[model samples]
Target: MKWTPQDIETYLNAKEYVDTAVVPLLAVSVGGEMKQSAAGAEFITLLSGHLERQFTGRLLLLPPFTYLKSNYGENTIRDLREWEANLAKEECKHIFYLTSELDWRTQEGGLIGTVIWLPSIPLEHMNDSQKMAVVDSQVKQLLELFTQKWHENQ
Candidate 1:
């Protein structure tokens, strides 16, 4: 389910079946490279929306967690873990953090959830059809991950 008032109501009632929450971790550059960060955010938004649609009945797609790349570090780890922990209170068994930021993968932090990092695609330069093609391939990977998680639970 996408994050919405109506969806939240359904989720509250059917939390038993909805066992996963998907969050997009986004970082914006505050120094001098705004264009690259904008492209990254667009890629993440498209990919995340597609993921939510594919798993609509099972997962909740939360808003993007935006932070300045210039200010990322130990505190970033804290914020991510804390966010995951708080989401656990919603009774979600799995939390998936999706992103195209390659830098986040190298950061050392406790894992409260699984992080799926895809290479950043330049969506702004691509035509809609081309963008959809990229999204399609990525969706397959995401579905496989979700399937693996579900089977493990059983």
Candidate 2:
């Protein structure tokens, strides 16, 4: 579910079943003029929309956490962990941070949850079929990750 009033109401009423929180980690360029970087951001948004639709009420999709790529550092990861703690209080046991940027390499001990980083696909120039194919593959991989987490928890 997304951050809408209707969805939030539904989520609150069904809080026990909504155990997962998916947060998209987006990196916005300084000026938002570079085409490739902008495309990555759009791809994250598109993929995130697909994720929300697939998981529906089981997943709470937060807005993209935007930051400058050049400024990515320990503090960013720290803030993400803090956000994870806040979400945990809301009863979300699994927090997934989805990103396309490869520069955010950090050790697992520092993070409070899982990070799913898929290569960015430039959908702006692709035909409709090509775009659909990429999204299909990405969703399949995400499902596998979610399944793995479910078993680990079990």
Candidate 3:
């Protein structure tokens, strides 16, 4: 199913906060013929804009790294772990993963696709409400963390 801005907002508003910090991660996939690089750039731009408008603090966007062909899942997990480590060094408090599926067009006009997101994170255990809550908290905590870190660094 397609995600909409309203969906994100609704989910965020409906979340219950625990003592844990949640980070927002987005995985986006686009059609192979659709210029994945450009799509990634656009997606980040849109996401950042949304954050700025809806949240009260600054948010940091990470650079996207391309996944290799072999053991993509394992690679994703490793990437996330490294990211977490780096953030930890910087005293970052939250981390979230977002994954997306994209369809690619081939010469035959058939669609090819890929799934991109951090690996090793389990989604099967989360109910719809729980997932929504996670998403909401992820966004919220990211902004919070960013602001907290920014001030500390200043």
Spell out the clash pairs found in candidate 1: none
| Tens-digit per-residue lDDT, 55-91, candidate 1 | 8888999999888888888888888888888888877
TM-score each candidate.
0.92, 0.91, 0.36
Residues 15-126, model 2: lDDT tens digits: 9998899888888775654676788887888888888899997899998888777777878777877888899887788888888887654535567678888788879878
Regions more than 4 Å wrong, model 3 = 1-41, 56-58, 65-71, 102-154
lDDT of 2 at 111: 73
Instruction: Encode model 3's per-residue lDDT on 1-154: one tens digit a residue.
Output: 0134654464355433211122333343455623544444444434444454554222233444445323346556556567567655654444333333222111112201111232222334677677555545545754665556436545
The most accurate candidate by TM-score is 1
Better of 1 and 2 by TM-score: 1
Lowest lDDT sum, 10 consecutive residues, model 1, at 103-112
CA displacement after TM-score superposition, residue 110 of candidate 1 (Å)? 1.0
Candidate 1: Cα lDDT at 57? 80
Instruction: Give the TM-score comparing model 2 with the true structure, all chains together.
Output: 0.91
Ranking by TM-score: 1, 2, 3
| lDDT of the candidates, in the order given | 0.85, 0.83, 0.40
Considering lDDT, which of the candidate structures 1 and 2 is the better prediction for this target? 1
